[model samples]
Target: MNIEANNTVNPEVKVGGQTLRWERQTIEKLLLANVREQRAARRWRMFKTLLWMALLAALVWALVAQPTLPKTPHSTGIGAGHTAMVSIKGVIADDGESSAEYILPALRSALEDSDSKALILLINSPGGSPVQAGLINDEIRRLRQKHDKPIYAVVEETCASAAYYIASAADQIYVDKASIVGSIGVLMDGFGFVDTLDKLGVERRLMTAGANKGFLDPFSPQTEEQRQFAQVMLDQIHQQFISVVKQGRGERLKETPEMFSGLFWTGEQSLQLGLADAYGSVDSVARDVVKAENLVDYSTEENIAERLAKRFGAAVGAGAVNALRSLPPLR
Candidate 1:
């Protein structure tokens, strides 16, 4: 007997009960989706990395690179002869516009320039830090001797205290008739908040390892010993300042009783007292005294953007240091 075996085939014969065509298609779609997701993730990572790098580079450039300032067309108007000019205006504090840090470089450049006939410091300041003034004074003396170039100080509105201190180092100090000059002295000033704290019923708690760590704390009551020590220190600094003035001015100073008593005088009176050599303006000094009518400004001024950037960078660095520090603070 010839018998034919029954033939049967299930529709869902592939793995996971799917047809071969459907299984292959599903696998292809999954692979494509995975590839697309991987590509997008890679692109996002690359973008983020590049963005961070760009930000870091910008920050570095801002902090490290010197900010360029636009030179005015009239800045280089030293017509036939070269008369290098550096300005010392405002407070002469270590960090101020009239600080030695800014003035010294300009002075060096002016002195080093063979084309420069002379150097002039245009002064219009009420004075500030004696330390800064002393530094500039020393440098001016050295540069003058080295370069064999005469440096003159031409006072504008005022040149008192530290301003006068620096000007004393110049070969000659010229001033306007009404210019305020002198004030050869030193002072350490501060405010005491102990009474204010007592009125407010606020108690200050301070801890320190060193004995004199809270030496000049405003919240704490000062002892007689502390007061004496402070006075002694001030006296020493005052003597140092007096010595410098004497050394710089020599016999030119009239040696008045109030000269070193923090007393200021007019430019005309300064000439009589030998504090100033003559009465002249910048133009007059450059033309008549220096014999070079042309004036070339070498003064460096920081723009607002540069100042802000520097302050921001300094603040960021200080904040980082302060965050890591756990030392006792002075009140």
Candidate 2:
């Protein structure tokens, strides 16, 4: 009897004068597949790492980048005589765009430019922090005296309260006929939630080391003494604001009983009241008054990077607060 070979059990098979190892071929294919998989995984990991690094770099740049100044024709050496402009827009707070920190630097740069015949303060704001306004006001006067460059305030839509406080420092104030002007006053505003809490039967638990530590806490009740004290402080600040305006306006101010009563008026009425010098815009003032047709903006505006960084900071702070709130309270 002839015996046939079992192809299934055979590790190697001979065909066409060549020996082929079936098990070796299977093993090789598996190894290749594993290698390819590992390579693909490594590539993905590298891509993720690079993406993370790029994001980190961008965040770092945003945090460290300086604010960009407005590009003007006078960026290089002063070529021709021009009127320098610094915009005081939005709320005039310590952390706002029209803050003294930002405004003062722009003012100095504009005044220091030899080609600039005059500086114009383009103001449009409802008003904000008194302290910030006061600082800007003081610097404007000082810069004018030092540089011997006349500074004029050109009001647009509105210039009231703290906005007017800084504008008062200018040599002359020009306003549009329909512009809102004045509001020479001080105010401290807040809401009282004590009554609401009582109606809701919600108790407020507050602890403070000092008696006046929680003076203006909205959740708590305010004492008569505290109210009186706050009023006194506001009165003092109001007086200071009034004095500054008087000094800045000098003989031009036509003070009335309601002028400093936190009242606003039209720009036309402002001129009649001597709160403004004349009717003019930035262009008209630069062309006719300053005698320099060429205009150069020296405003120190917040750049994209600075704004991004600020927003990022706020987001991180809010996230942290939320995380803290979500945590379990300690015994």
Candidate 3:
């Protein structure tokens, strides 16, 4: 007896002259692909969640570990004798660690405390913004007068330009024998890329609403009027610096041809010129001059976590502005 094949019950596929079951193979492949896709999606979600959690943890840690200002060294809270010390290191800018923002607060704290007999500014700087230095200088003088407490500036490596501007306001300026001392002048500086652009056959395209809006543009050809204007401004600022030095040093400054010619000198030469008073360190000034042996630092500094957070936050900004090649010159 011969039986007919059941086509409805079993589907078949012929491959290379060999019959194969089609339905089971198709179902198995589809199931495997779906499982793989699901697993990949789950893994991606887990990764995203972990990244967010890590960021949250870092934020929490930074907020919790806020930096604390250093305390003074008086045994009795409001006692008779202690020297207040504030560090003035690095470039002095409006937003920097060694600027009027931090220095004035430390000065005020030192002055307001009854136990603080005197304030000592320990300086090691190549100078920076004149405006910031002037603000700090003015505040120091005002505080000194108000509290009747002496404030001394002790130079370590360098005290030039704006740093000297600040130091000149102090009651006394002390320094190490090898320290670099003065730069009492102002200048507006820039590079001229007009020649370079001309050589490269590149034309500059700059537009401004105001006549002098792009005053110090390096790519543009410098005009005589602009040069004169800049010179006048620098001369005015230089005169102001000279006047300040004269006021601070009084008759002690020896008049010389190149004294205020934007020149620096050794600490010994500075003492000779009355730019500085004596050879001394922070320790010596605190011990011998202030008569308070204990030294406490009142320098404002960003902790590691805060710096990292700032870098992280500014990463996008940095990347966005990386292509901006043209920037204004500095004074």
lDDT of each: 0.83, 0.89, 0.84
Per-residue error for 175 in candidate 2, Å, reads 0.4
Any idea how many clashes model 2 has? 0
Better of 1 and 3 by TM-score: 3
Query: Which residue ranges in model 3 land beyond 4 Å of their true spot?
Result: 1-52, 64-79, 312-331
Window of ten residues with lowest summed lDDT in model 3: 67-76
Model 1, runs deviating above 4 Å: 1-80, 318-331
Which residue pairs collide in model 1, if any?
none
**Candidate 2, which segments miss by more than 4 Å at Cα?**
1-75, 315-331
Model 2 TM-score (2 dp): 0.79
What's the residue-level lDDT of 1 in candidate 3?
36
lDDT, candidate 2, 1-331, per-residue tens: 3333346775555665567877889999999999999999999999999996886687678646654553333343656588999999999988777988788888888887778899999999999999999999999989889979999999999999999999999999999999999999999999999999999999999999999999899998999999999999999999999999999999999889999999999999999999999999999999999999888888887766677668878999999999999999998
Candidate 2: worst-modelled 10 consecutive residues by lDDT: 67-76
